[model samples]
Target: MSIVFEPVRGRPNSGGRLTVGTLYYGDARYPIRIEDRALAHLKIVILTKLRRNESFALSWEKKPADGSGRGTVWIHPALSFHFEFSGSKEPEINMAWLEKMSESANRTLGLRIDDEPREGEADPAAARAGV
Candidate 1:
């Protein structure tokens, strides 16, 4: 007989807690660590535009470890997307921040990830988009 064991997962961090989540891009296996709150906002903006057949660029500043430059991608409706969240509870969506992002998505530069705006309330777009 042989005995095997798997490593434990979902261990909490030391000291200060993290509101962090990882976003894995495609089957290529790129992992992007993002704050849970911001990812929640981004999920809305990214999918909403795709639903309307609007294509745009999505950019995020790479961390120092990732070479400290900005990375971007052309986001089109044809591309496949799946958002996986770690927490069982969904992070609250901030409307003001979403509006800021949506407006930027409509611009020529596409959707550049910016620092979050002041937190606010509900998304009127969700109702209109029939989600």
Candidate 2:
């Protein structure tokens, strides 16, 4: 399976921009159904790292709890990256989450997804052990 995510602006707006972009992996493409807030946070982290020519790992939980574990990808500036936005207005920004994710990316472990950044810890080993 391939990993994909949609980039969207943050909430609290009247615009109905459903999807910002289709993140493609290999030959497969999947819609990024994550909430707008989380997606916005992710986009900021990704762009900041890539803009500096830094490569890091991005990990996220997989749906359906199929026992396969979480998904991770190494993001680099050289990759064929693209983000399509449906609206001209920028979404609301979550600075705290972006800072946290940025700090994680700068670490050796890279960035791990916390759908709700304040809700739980991001431990891949713990997640795998649970399954």
Candidate 3:
């Protein structure tokens, strides 16, 4: 499946709906409009953390555009289980593409993909087996 990237900005009027700009991927540069409420799963993840009163980091690397540095973002979307980025140090992941990748990862792996690992945890399977 094709991925999409969009620039996100915080809006004052809306409570948590971030504005997006310039969706790019696979010959498509259309506009993207996503509200915080629309990404329900992400919201669930974020709220869970917020309820626990924890802080974390989120990151993604985007494919290079215009031959410059790639897309990436490291932010704390405290209200959701995932995050979005528009810039990256690694060219393979993009902020705009993070949601979809997380969705797919969650679907295939049957687990949550957050920005950081739990304390003392290095692998997903390790937690599953109670290691």
Candidate 4:
């Protein structure tokens, strides 16, 4: 089954900007459980493209046992969007991963979501760039 992540416009606070969102699967909607840092990174990537009137595909691998290979969605600026957060605090952003994901979104093949970033992982474009 495909899931939809809706971005919520959060209120500003003394600490920093907060972004909260939700993940919708099937008939159920759940408050996004992603780390605030990662969620923020995704927000920037998505909004940047949308603001530029760019449309791109976002793909994520499916659970192996689910028998589905991957899930993808076409994101566009004209579409209605929202981001909602359940908490008041924000997590530290991971600049490396954000950069990697942003690069992937710019590639001809489109963005492909992978496991959360880890130390020493090769640059995401290395494989696609044939370097």
Best of the candidates, lDDT:
1
State the TM-score for model 1: 0.70
- Which ranges in model 4 have alpha carbons more than 4 Å from their true place? 1-36, 65-67, 119-131
* Clashing residue pairs found in predicted model 1: none
Residue 59 in candidate 3 has what lDDT?
30
> What are the per-residue Cα lDDT tens digits for candidate 4 across 96-127?
57777788999877875444566566656665
Candidate 4 pairs with clashing backbones: 7-82, 7-83, 8-82, 8-83, 8-84, 20-84, 20-85, 21-84
What does candidate 4 score on TM? 0.61
Question: In model 3, which range of ten residues has the least summed lDDT?
Answer: 85-94
Looking at model 1, which ten-residue stretch has the lowest summed lDDT?
1-10
Give candidate 3 regions above 4 Å deviation. 1-38, 65-131
lDDT of 2 by residue, 23-130 (tens): 543333554344445556677888888788889987776555333457767788877655545555566665555766777888887886553434344544445579
Instruction: Report RMSD (Å) for each prediction in the order shown.
Output: 10.3, 8.3, 15.0, 7.8
* Candidates in descending lDDT order: 1, 2, 4, 3
Pick the winner on TM-score between candidates 1 and 4. Answer: 1
Name the top TM-score candidate.
Answer: 1
Ranking by TM-score: 1, 4, 2, 3
